[model samples]
Target: MSDATRPDPDPSIAELEAQEQRLTLTRFTHDDAWTLGSLLVELARQRQAPVAIDIRRGGQQLFHAALPGSTPDNDAWIDRKRRVVERYGNSSYLVGARYRAKDTTFEASSRLDLDRYAAHGGSFPITVEGAGVIGTVTVSGLPQLEDHMMVVEALERFRDS
Candidate 1:
Protein backbone atom coordinates (compact mmCIF):
# COMPACT_ATOMS: atom_id res chain seq x y z
CA MET A 1 0.00 0.00 0.00
CA SER A 2 1.08 3.57 -0.59
CA ASP A 3 2.14 5.66 2.39
CA ALA A 4 -0.97 7.75 2.00
CA THR A 5 -3.15 4.68 2.38
CA ARG A 6 -1.32 3.28 5.39
CA PRO A 7 -3.21 3.42 8.66
CA ASP A 8 -1.85 5.60 11.42
CA PRO A 9 -0.55 3.76 14.45
CA ASP A 10 -2.09 6.25 16.79
CA PRO A 11 -5.15 5.02 18.68
CA SER A 12 -8.66 6.15 17.91
CA ILE A 13 -11.14 7.69 20.34
CA ALA A 14 -12.72 4.29 21.00
CA GLU A 15 -9.33 2.86 21.93
CA LEU A 16 -8.59 5.74 24.23
CA GLU A 17 -11.97 5.36 25.94
CA ALA A 18 -11.26 1.68 26.42
CA GLN A 19 -8.00 2.54 28.14
CA GLU A 20 -9.79 4.79 30.65
CA GLN A 21 -12.28 2.02 31.36
CA ARG A 22 -9.56 -0.54 31.84
CA LEU A 23 -7.29 1.56 34.07
CA THR A 24 -10.03 2.43 36.54
CA LEU A 25 -9.78 1.00 40.05
CA THR A 26 -12.52 -0.66 42.01
CA ARG A 27 -11.28 1.03 45.17
CA PHE A 28 -8.60 3.53 46.09
CA THR A 29 -7.21 4.79 49.36
CA HIS A 30 -4.36 6.61 51.04
CA ASP A 31 -2.54 3.29 51.27
CA ASP A 32 -2.71 3.01 47.51
CA ALA A 33 -1.16 6.44 47.30
CA TRP A 34 1.84 5.25 49.33
CA THR A 35 2.30 2.13 47.25
CA LEU A 36 1.92 3.71 43.85
CA GLY A 37 3.82 6.87 44.68
CA SER A 38 6.78 4.96 46.08
CA LEU A 39 6.84 2.68 43.09
CA LEU A 40 6.60 5.61 40.69
CA VAL A 41 9.48 7.38 42.36
CA GLU A 42 11.61 4.27 42.35
CA LEU A 43 10.91 3.70 38.69
CA ALA A 44 11.96 7.24 37.78
CA ARG A 45 15.03 6.98 39.95
CA GLN A 46 16.05 3.72 38.34
CA ARG A 47 15.81 5.41 34.97
CA GLN A 48 17.66 8.45 36.28
CA ALA A 49 14.77 10.54 35.15
CA PRO A 50 14.35 14.14 36.21
CA VAL A 51 10.61 14.30 36.57
CA ALA A 52 7.86 15.63 38.77
CA ILE A 53 5.20 13.30 40.08
CA ASP A 54 1.96 14.00 41.87
CA ILE A 55 -0.94 12.05 43.31
CA ARG A 56 -3.97 13.88 44.58
CA ARG A 57 -7.39 13.02 45.89
CA GLY A 58 -10.07 15.62 45.61
CA GLY A 59 -8.38 18.93 46.35
CA GLN A 60 -5.68 17.40 48.55
CA GLN A 61 -2.37 16.02 47.45
CA LEU A 62 -1.41 12.62 48.81
CA PHE A 63 2.05 12.41 47.29
CA HIS A 64 4.35 14.74 45.38
CA ALA A 65 8.00 14.68 44.42
CA ALA A 66 10.51 16.15 42.04
CA LEU A 67 13.65 14.31 41.08
CA PRO A 68 17.05 15.93 40.66
CA GLY A 69 17.22 18.23 37.59
CA SER A 70 13.49 18.78 37.65
CA THR A 71 12.69 22.48 37.62
CA PRO A 72 9.78 24.77 38.29
CA ASP A 73 8.73 24.29 34.66
CA ASN A 74 8.25 20.61 35.33
CA ASP A 75 6.04 21.46 38.27
CA ALA A 76 3.93 23.71 36.11
CA TRP A 77 3.58 20.98 33.51
CA ILE A 78 2.51 18.54 36.21
CA ASP A 79 -0.22 20.86 37.36
CA ARG A 80 -1.37 21.39 33.80
CA LYS A 81 -1.42 17.72 33.00
CA ARG A 82 -3.25 16.89 36.25
CA ARG A 83 -5.96 19.37 35.36
CA VAL A 84 -6.24 17.82 31.91
CA VAL A 85 -6.98 14.44 33.44
CA GLU A 86 -9.49 15.92 35.84
CA ARG A 87 -11.22 17.85 33.08
CA TYR A 88 -11.37 15.00 30.61
CA GLY A 89 -11.77 12.04 33.00
CA ASN A 90 -9.07 10.24 31.02
CA SER A 91 -5.35 10.24 30.44
CA SER A 92 -4.00 13.64 29.41
CA TYR A 93 -2.25 12.00 26.48
CA LEU A 94 -5.47 10.40 25.33
CA VAL A 95 -7.33 13.66 25.48
CA GLY A 96 -4.69 15.32 23.35
CA ALA A 97 -4.67 12.43 20.95
CA ARG A 98 -8.43 12.66 20.57
CA TYR A 99 -8.12 16.29 19.59
CA ARG A 100 -5.27 15.53 17.22
CA ALA A 101 -7.39 12.89 15.55
CA LYS A 102 -10.18 15.37 15.03
CA ASP A 103 -7.73 17.92 13.62
CA THR A 104 -8.76 20.32 16.38
CA THR A 105 -6.97 21.90 19.28
CA PHE A 106 -7.83 21.50 22.97
CA GLU A 107 -7.42 25.18 23.66
CA ALA A 108 -9.88 26.07 20.92
CA SER A 109 -12.74 23.94 22.21
CA SER A 110 -11.89 23.67 25.90
CA ARG A 111 -12.06 27.45 26.50
CA LEU A 112 -10.00 26.88 29.65
CA ASP A 113 -6.77 28.74 30.07
CA LEU A 114 -4.11 26.94 28.05
CA ASP A 115 -1.49 28.15 30.48
CA ARG A 116 -3.24 26.62 33.48
CA TYR A 117 -4.33 23.39 31.79
CA ALA A 118 -2.26 21.34 29.39
CA ALA A 119 -3.40 18.69 26.97
CA HIS A 120 0.00 17.17 26.70
CA GLY A 121 0.56 13.90 28.60
CA GLY A 122 1.51 12.06 31.79
CA SER A 123 -1.73 12.39 33.71
CA PHE A 124 -4.45 9.88 34.52
CA PRO A 125 -7.67 10.18 36.45
CA ILE A 126 -8.11 8.22 39.66
CA THR A 127 -11.44 6.64 38.99
CA VAL A 128 -13.25 4.56 41.59
CA GLU A 129 -16.00 2.14 40.72
CA GLY A 130 -18.97 3.98 42.16
CA ALA A 131 -17.41 7.27 43.12
CA GLY A 132 -16.15 8.18 39.66
CA VAL A 133 -12.98 10.23 39.23
CA ILE A 134 -11.91 11.65 42.57
CA GLY A 135 -8.40 12.81 41.68
CA THR A 136 -5.40 12.61 39.37
CA VAL A 137 -1.82 11.39 39.16
CA THR A 138 0.63 13.21 36.91
CA VAL A 139 4.25 13.01 35.83
CA SER A 140 6.21 15.58 33.83
CA GLY A 141 9.73 16.07 32.44
CA LEU A 142 10.28 13.57 29.67
CA PRO A 143 8.76 13.78 26.23
CA GLN A 144 4.98 13.73 26.40
CA LEU A 145 4.64 10.15 25.13
CA GLU A 146 7.34 8.84 27.45
CA ASP A 147 5.83 10.65 30.41
CA HIS A 148 2.46 9.08 29.69
CA MET A 149 3.97 5.63 29.21
CA MET A 150 5.90 5.69 32.46
CA VAL A 151 2.80 6.59 34.46
CA VAL A 152 0.79 3.87 32.78
CA GLU A 153 3.52 1.29 33.27
CA ALA A 154 3.80 2.09 36.95
CA LEU A 155 0.07 1.86 37.43
CA GLU A 156 -0.08 -1.44 35.58
CA ARG A 157 2.61 -2.93 37.76
CA PHE A 158 0.99 -1.61 40.92
CA ARG A 159 -2.42 -2.96 39.96
CA ASP A 160 -1.14 -6.42 39.07
CA SER A 161 0.95 -6.81 42.18
Candidate 2:
Protein backbone atom coordinates (compact mmCIF):
# COMPACT_ATOMS: atom_id res chain seq x y z
CA MET A 1 0.00 0.00 0.00
CA SER A 2 1.02 3.57 -0.50
CA ASP A 3 2.34 5.39 2.52
CA ALA A 4 -0.83 7.41 2.83
CA THR A 5 -3.03 4.34 2.55
CA ARG A 6 -1.01 2.15 4.86
CA PRO A 7 -2.51 1.16 8.19
CA ASP A 8 -1.19 2.55 11.47
CA PRO A 9 0.34 0.06 13.88
CA ASP A 10 -0.57 1.20 17.37
CA PRO A 11 -1.46 -0.19 20.76
CA SER A 12 -4.79 -0.16 22.53
CA ILE A 13 -6.01 3.11 23.99
CA ALA A 14 -5.66 1.69 27.50
CA GLU A 15 -2.01 0.90 26.92
CA LEU A 16 -1.35 4.30 25.42
CA GLU A 17 -3.13 5.96 28.34
CA ALA A 18 -0.83 4.07 30.67
CA GLN A 19 2.11 5.50 28.78
CA GLU A 20 0.73 9.04 28.91
CA GLN A 21 0.07 8.77 32.60
CA ARG A 22 3.61 7.66 33.31
CA LEU A 23 5.31 10.04 30.89
CA THR A 24 4.07 13.18 32.55
CA LEU A 25 6.77 15.47 33.87
CA THR A 26 6.89 17.99 36.65
CA ARG A 27 8.29 20.56 34.24
CA PHE A 28 9.04 20.80 30.55
CA THR A 29 11.66 23.22 29.29
CA HIS A 30 13.39 24.25 26.10
CA ASP A 31 16.52 22.59 27.42
CA ASP A 32 14.51 19.45 28.02
CA ALA A 33 13.38 19.51 24.42
CA TRP A 34 17.00 19.64 23.31
CA THR A 35 17.93 16.68 25.45
CA LEU A 36 14.94 14.63 24.34
CA GLY A 37 15.52 15.37 20.68
CA SER A 38 19.18 14.51 20.96
CA LEU A 39 18.44 11.24 22.73
CA LEU A 40 15.89 10.19 20.12
CA VAL A 41 18.28 11.00 17.27
CA GLU A 42 21.05 9.01 18.90
CA LEU A 43 18.77 6.04 19.44
CA ALA A 44 17.62 6.05 15.83
CA ARG A 45 21.18 6.44 14.62
CA GLN A 46 22.36 3.51 16.71
CA ARG A 47 19.61 1.39 15.26
CA GLN A 48 20.18 2.73 11.73
CA ALA A 49 16.58 3.85 11.71
CA PRO A 50 15.37 6.71 9.59
CA VAL A 51 13.34 9.05 11.76
CA ALA A 52 12.22 12.62 11.89
CA ILE A 53 12.11 14.43 15.21
CA ASP A 54 10.54 17.66 16.40
CA ILE A 55 10.08 19.36 19.76
CA ARG A 56 7.94 22.43 19.87
CA ARG A 57 6.95 24.78 22.70
CA GLY A 58 4.25 27.39 22.67
CA GLY A 59 3.84 27.33 18.92
CA GLN A 60 7.56 27.66 18.42
CA GLN A 61 9.78 25.01 16.94
CA LEU A 62 12.56 24.32 19.37
CA PHE A 63 14.30 21.43 17.68
CA HIS A 64 13.79 19.49 14.45
CA ALA A 65 15.80 16.94 12.56
CA ALA A 66 15.22 14.53 9.72
CA LEU A 67 17.65 11.68 9.97
CA PRO A 68 19.40 10.03 7.07
CA GLY A 69 17.01 8.20 4.72
CA SER A 70 14.01 10.16 5.96
CA THR A 71 11.87 11.73 3.31
CA PRO A 72 10.01 14.99 3.13
CA ASP A 73 6.84 13.11 3.84
CA ASN A 74 8.09 12.33 7.33
CA ASP A 75 8.21 16.06 8.05
CA ALA A 76 4.57 16.34 7.09
CA TRP A 77 3.71 13.43 9.31
CA ILE A 78 5.45 15.07 12.23
CA ASP A 79 3.41 18.24 11.77
CA ARG A 80 0.16 16.35 11.51
CA LYS A 81 0.87 14.22 14.55
CA ARG A 82 1.93 17.26 16.55
CA ARG A 83 -1.29 18.97 15.59
CA VAL A 84 -3.15 16.10 17.24
CA VAL A 85 -1.07 16.64 20.38
CA GLU A 86 -1.83 20.37 20.41
CA ARG A 87 -5.55 19.78 19.93
CA TYR A 88 -6.09 16.89 22.32
CA GLY A 89 -3.45 17.49 25.00
CA ASN A 90 -2.55 13.83 24.52
CA SER A 91 -0.17 11.75 22.54
CA SER A 92 -1.01 11.30 18.90
CA TYR A 93 -0.85 7.53 19.37
CA LEU A 94 -3.39 7.74 22.14
CA VAL A 95 -5.61 9.89 20.01
CA GLY A 96 -5.58 7.35 17.22
CA ALA A 97 -6.09 4.48 19.61
CA ARG A 98 -9.08 6.25 21.08
CA TYR A 99 -10.58 6.33 17.64
CA ARG A 100 -9.84 2.66 17.15
CA ALA A 101 -11.50 1.89 20.44
CA LYS A 102 -14.65 3.33 18.94
CA ASP A 103 -13.97 1.56 15.61
CA THR A 104 -13.48 4.83 13.72
CA THR A 105 -10.85 7.28 12.51
CA PHE A 106 -10.18 10.84 13.66
CA GLU A 107 -11.46 12.13 10.37
CA ALA A 108 -14.61 10.10 10.74
CA SER A 109 -15.26 11.31 14.24
CA SER A 110 -13.99 14.88 14.07
CA ARG A 111 -14.38 15.62 10.35
CA LEU A 112 -11.04 17.42 10.43
CA ASP A 113 -8.85 17.61 7.40
CA LEU A 114 -7.01 14.31 7.12
CA ASP A 115 -3.78 15.93 5.94
CA ARG A 116 -3.76 18.57 8.61
CA TYR A 117 -4.53 16.47 11.64
CA ALA A 118 -3.33 12.88 11.75
CA ALA A 119 -4.11 10.81 14.81
CA HIS A 120 -1.11 8.54 14.54
CA GLY A 121 1.73 7.53 16.77
CA GLY A 122 4.83 9.65 17.51
CA SER A 123 3.80 13.05 18.82
CA PHE A 124 3.42 13.53 22.59
CA PRO A 125 2.33 16.50 24.62
CA ILE A 126 5.05 18.18 26.64
CA THR A 127 2.98 18.74 29.73
CA VAL A 128 4.00 20.26 33.02
CA GLU A 129 2.15 19.89 36.29
CA GLY A 130 -0.01 23.00 36.91
CA ALA A 131 1.26 24.42 33.64
CA GLY A 132 -0.82 22.14 31.47
CA VAL A 133 0.37 21.23 27.97
CA ILE A 134 3.00 23.61 26.73
CA GLY A 135 4.30 21.89 23.65
CA THR A 136 4.83 18.60 21.81
CA VAL A 137 7.58 16.13 21.02
CA THR A 138 7.21 14.18 17.82
CA VAL A 139 8.90 11.45 15.81
CA SER A 140 8.05 9.70 12.53
CA GLY A 141 9.47 7.21 9.98
CA LEU A 142 8.72 4.02 11.88
CA PRO A 143 5.57 2.00 12.23
CA GLN A 144 3.16 4.10 14.27
CA LEU A 145 3.49 1.91 17.36
CA GLU A 146 7.27 1.93 17.34
CA ASP A 147 7.30 5.66 16.89
CA HIS A 148 5.02 6.06 19.87
CA MET A 149 6.97 3.67 22.06
CA MET A 150 10.27 5.36 21.30
CA VAL A 151 8.94 8.71 22.42
CA VAL A 152 7.43 7.21 25.56
CA GLU A 153 10.67 5.47 26.47
CA ALA A 154 12.65 8.64 25.90
CA LEU A 155 10.26 10.56 28.10
CA GLU A 156 10.61 7.94 30.82
CA ARG A 157 14.35 8.38 30.73
CA PHE A 158 13.91 12.12 30.90
CA ARG A 159 11.54 11.83 33.82
CA ASP A 160 13.98 9.68 35.74
CA SER A 161 16.90 11.95 35.13
CA lDDT of each prediction against the hidden true structure: 0.87, 0.87
Which tens-of-lDDT digit does each residue in 45-74 have in candidate 2? 998889999999997999998999999999
> Which pairs of residues collide in model 2?
none
What would the TM-score be for candidate 1 when compared with the true structure? 0.89
Clashing pairs in 1: none
**Model 2, which residues run further than 4 Å from truth?**
1-10
Candidate maximizing TM-score: 2
Reference-based TM-score of each model = 0.89, 0.90
Weakest 10 consecutive residues, lDDT, candidate 1? 7-16
* Backbone clashes, each candidate: 0, 0
